[model samples]
Target: MGERLAGAEKEVLVEIVRFTQKNGLKGAEGGWKDFLARNDKKFGASVSDPKKRTKDVLLAFLVTFSKDFQKYFRKLVRRHAERRAIEQYMNEFSGRISPEQKLVQLTTEHLDYRKNYYFPSYQEGWKVMRIGKVSSSMNSGAMLAIDCEMVLCHDGTEAVVRVCVVDNKLEVKLDTLVNPLKAVADYRTHITGVSKKDLEGVTCSLVDIQKSLKKILAKGKILVGHSLYRDLYALKFDYSRVIDTAYIFKYANLPTTSTASLNSLCKSVCGYSVREDGEPHNCLKDAEAAMNLVTAKLKHGFNDPIEIAENSVPEPDQMKLLAHRIPVYLPCQELLKIFSGNPSIDEKIDSRIRGEFYSTCISFNDIDEADKAFDELDGQETKDSSGRLQKSVLLKRDNGDVAGFFVRKMVYGSRLSNSEVLKKRPQPTENTEQKKEDANGDNRKRQRTSKKHAKKAKAPVVE
Candidate 1:
């Protein structure tokens, strides 16, 4: 059986080692020194106080013996003791029961797994709906990012949580306290940093925090977060639409082979240096940092192109253009009518009426048929009088149906001059006048040849 120590015990061991190493000791000699001194004061007292003395001596002897064993046979003894505990715990488990209420057992098992694993469970029935696929599908709308912080506290202990939202939406919600949920509070007089008083006035229940978070996140529209699975699991929210920044970053080839945490991603991509002024693991700061990360990279570019925008593109004009020309999943078809060329519709059209067009075939009853016919043709990308590539496409379709598909070739986000980089379709070298003269000469030669043939046929007939 596998044996696992609790985080508190691991921390105790870590602290002991850290103290010993800093003081240049083989083991935890520093704490042992204090232990010895405290024991001497209690045990080496008058014989009249024999009860206290005996207890103190016993404790001192145990400490000394443990230290000696640690020096001589460190890992072996620890492992053996751990294995014994593991076996005892495993043996004490009750046998599983197949209950009449099957759903009850399933839910109990589900909750147990989530709590034990400290992560969300993927229970969808689709073959492709695995953990990774669920993560991607839910987070696809991560556009309109938001950066924020969440403060978490328990048992008079406090910590900060940083959060980043992509597309201002959440797939999974989380309300977990950091530094392991059950860490001992070190309210030290020597170190006047974190204290009970500091976290006193602002203390609130987990549920209260969750409610507040819900309000704050109402604007997110969609959520994109890092290790969001764990957070959502903790929050008890079955958030299915969250885009895991960790997953997206890795897929984008951002040098993150392992589970990409926010801190790691920030340091590598944006040269972000985490400050120690605030508590090390503030959720809000982390979230803000994440939002900044995607937007900055998107507005700019990535190491390669893999760092796709966690949210939809934010340019309003671009969005409007997309809304007008492409399918934006909206109901209104205003922009669609603008593109169709109807001379009668032109009279109703306001010259200064600047609004986006949409793709809807339904004619508006209030507007005349000519006016309301969803302009499906003749709308061309408006060009400047001088004929430079002005933010839109130029009209070139032979059928006057700008509505139909056409090949578009332009260097996107290119720095090269238009004339230099954009190779126009090869123009005919010969002048139009010369081309016409050549065509006329060819027609005359064809006519003369036909006449000669006719004359030869007549001579044959006469013979």
Candidate 2:
């Protein structure tokens, strides 16, 4: 029994070693097989029982195979293989998830939602996501700030991208010239100082950059320079959790501020010295500046750390305008028009309609917070030209209150066209008489005050 066990153990080791040696033997491969054959007799009798001996031999065969071709196996199971598996899983899961389920997930997991985060309209509801505050002690989700610098290609139509990511420190994600499929006009000289020679051997397609960006975005949410709208417009990413420094600056109410020039903000908030280089744009540097701005705000007050003024209430006129544009939540129309030249209307409403309607109505107040909601709504109206729908709208304001109003499809189109009703009014609602009286009165008083100011400027009176 002892001899058999020793023989079996020796067989296993020999098989492992022989397998490891076979591939390395090159054209003169007889050395590995010859060595294995010489040792086989010693292990063949290691197991006395016929069945046990065959079983041991089989195991040894597998072990030998693995050891001999371990390099090939390792190559097959690299990161690329793992990524293929991940993509397959994502494709299957995406196909299985229903639209309702996607909506629920977006609301409960994907958004930057606080406990009482408001939604002003049903359309804006999609942007809502449940977000939990992360504690520093627990290292779980990490936020990354990314900036991409682009250059114009010689073809007058592509951009070279230099991407940087900021987690705690700055790191380069990608540095390459991307071929933007559009024309590269002379205006590109302002951003990318790339001459024709510089673009040689350094050009890649927008598709290549987009594929790379998709991989990068898949990893995490990226804070971008304030003008994220333009960047995202260029790249195809439903950019997740993007905190635009431009939007932040606007929300934080910083005057004479822009993300393009980082020096002013850096000096005020992060105390970092940054010098501009005339080389092709460095996106990584921009991403770092954006991250630093946010970090400073999170560490200190918005003003002291980010060099922005404290949050001040908007003027009354501005507040009134915001209140006007807040989305009115409405139920999904039962009969969605498909434009097949025939209308199929479903009059039998779902039993849950009332509950769903109420829930959506609650979100309308939340949509009111965004000042630019109207402009966005205009875009949506253009996209969804079904022209058969119900829109919850702010009613004519009377007695210092905006009432609820519902305009059917045809009515909305007419209302939109009527200059008298849709005129850009300075105030929400005022009688024509009141407007005329103010215009006449203020004009005379302003003219007299201007004359007096001019007279005073010409001759200084001695007191």
The Cα local distance difference test for each model comes to 0.35, 0.38
Which candidate wins on lDDT? Answer: 2
Q: Tell me each candidate's RMSD, in Å, in order.
A: 29.3, 26.5
State model 1's lDDT: 0.35
Q: Estimate, for each residue in 60-136, the C-alpha lDDT of model 1 and write its tens digit.
A: 33234344434322332243344344334334532321111111122223322222222222223111111122222
Error of 2 at 50 (Å): 86
Task: Give the C-alpha miss distance for residue 429 in model 1, angstroms.
Answer: 65
Q: Which ten residues in a row have the lowest lDDT in candidate 1?
A: 405-414
Give a tens-digit lDDT track for model 2, residues 1-463: 1233223343333333333333333212233344335447775333322233344543343334333343332322232233343335435666553322222223223122211121111221122221222121112234466655555545743343444465645565666655454555443554654444555565586567667666654533333453554455444333334555544432222221112245445654567644343444545666777767766655554532133221112122121111112222422231121111222232222211232131111111222332333332221122113322333443333243433322222112212334633563245468998899899999987877877676644322111
Q: How close is candidate 2 to the true structure, as a TM-score?
A: 0.34
Candidate 1 ranges with C-alpha deviation above 4 Å: 1-195, 216-220, 251-257, 276-279, 300-463
C-alpha TM-scores of all predictions: 0.27, 0.34
Residue ranges of candidate 2 with Cα displaced over 4 Å: 1-140, 150-162, 181-183, 249-261, 276-281, 301-463
